[model samples]
Target: MAERVYPKLIGARLRGQTSYRASFALQCVSSGLGQLVELGVILILFGRVTSLGGFSVTEVVLMYAIAGVGFGLADMVAGQLDELPAHIRTGTFDVVLMRPLGTLAQVMASDVHLRKIGRIVASLVALVWALAHNDIAWSPATALLVVLAPLSGAVIFSSIWVVANAVCFWLVEGQELANAVTYGSGSFTSYPATVYGPWLRRFFAFVVPGSFVAYYPGLALLGRPDPLGGPALLGWVSPLVAVATAAVAGLVWRFAVRHYRGTGS
Candidate 1:
């Protein structure tokens, strides 16, 4: 069963992506170049300014590593961010629904973006360099958290991705709105939330839930305190947030699939 499903998923992606090799290559280059530019901007900031909001340049590099790995893994495993609406509009969802597997599983497993592997490799290398350059007091427990952070972060981002795609069942335009939460959350979390104002930090903690993924745990990892002096326990909440987000996203996905089948879209 695993053999069958794995190849089916991989083959689907190869066939789909073969039609636009030039576009796919361009997107990979664009993503890498964009990250390089952002890194350059950070270097410029750190060249003049010492640190921003208690986060050193190295610390921010760690945060970027965490965020990049999280976002990259999510996009690689689940690249159907824009496919749900297209499936609905074209009635391709019927084919998914007809599959013996769960509709959500089928939809999610249908495509894998191989270009994201470049991003993942790049982030991993940056993370290693950042770890070597920074002042991290690694013990048994801290080491565990460092490893778990990316796993939790990946799950959290994938949950956001699932929610984004599921919104397509309601309306095509909903996908755009969902980007505010999914992609915007990633962009915001890439920087230390402490750099943001009070209301923005609270929004990340309470509303969007991106704070738990990296910013808080990153503070703990870096042996720093939150400038707002928020609860230190927020760092430990990463796994809980990941599990909860996945559960909620799973329920939302189920409902969306049901709605799609019932409404014939």
Candidate 2:
């Protein structure tokens, strides 16, 4: 049954990941330190001014924390998409297709990095710091949205990675450029969307849905006014964006798999 299969695959991955303790530990530390360094930039920017592009230090940090944990969770699971090109290039994708498991689930569960816990922890610390200073009303709905935001964020990011990697089926050499969507957007969502021009913001909002991944959901959570002056209600659309993105990605991935005629390697 799928219930038993998913856990067995993921558990096996966790065990294999833990087999190399030193490497795992180093990655964890580095992941934490890297996030701190990004936070340091925000702190330094705030030291010079009250806010950046209308987002206060706490707000910006909150945005970063929400985005970081969301992206980190996505990366820990679906980062294997990055290796899809390699799988196809090496003719291993054929083997993957032959397996009893679903290709998407198998690829998603393939690279479960425990080091991403470092990024999650760093985000948690920042969230705590942000909550310490904010005047948020802890209403029941607010509580529910706060809980929903990060989980939806994970799905949003995972879908981005999935759709981007599906290109590997068409481009045999692989598209190294897909990082601009996944990794690049992770960096982009940490700041308020207002800092960018209408074109850039629209591209992210309409095309990639990066706005829903963190910025918009964050706007609603903090009860802060949108810098671009959109309806505050846009924040609630984050879950819809996540679901829609995943649906499209699933369709693309399935179509790509159907079309993949392995290179005569």
Top candidate, metric lDDT: 2
Off by over 4 Å in 1: 1-3, 11-30, 261-265
lDDT digits (tens) for residues 112-199 of candidate 2? 8778888888887887787678778788987788777888889989999998889889987656777778887788888889878899
What is the Cα-based TM-score of model 1? 0.88
Q: Where does the lowest 10-residue lDDT sum fall in candidate 2?
A: 172-181
Question: Each model's C-alpha lDDT?
Answer: 0.80, 0.85
Candidate 2's displacement at residue 40, Å, is 1.3
Winning model by TM-score:
2
TM-scores for all candidates: the values are: 0.88, 0.95
Q: What is the lDDT of residue 52 in candidate 2?
A: 82
List the RMSD of every prediction in angstroms: 2.7, 1.5
Total backbone collisions for each predicted model: 0, 0
* lDDT string, candidate 1, 85-162, tens digits: 778887888887776777777776778787776677777777888889888889987788888888898899899888
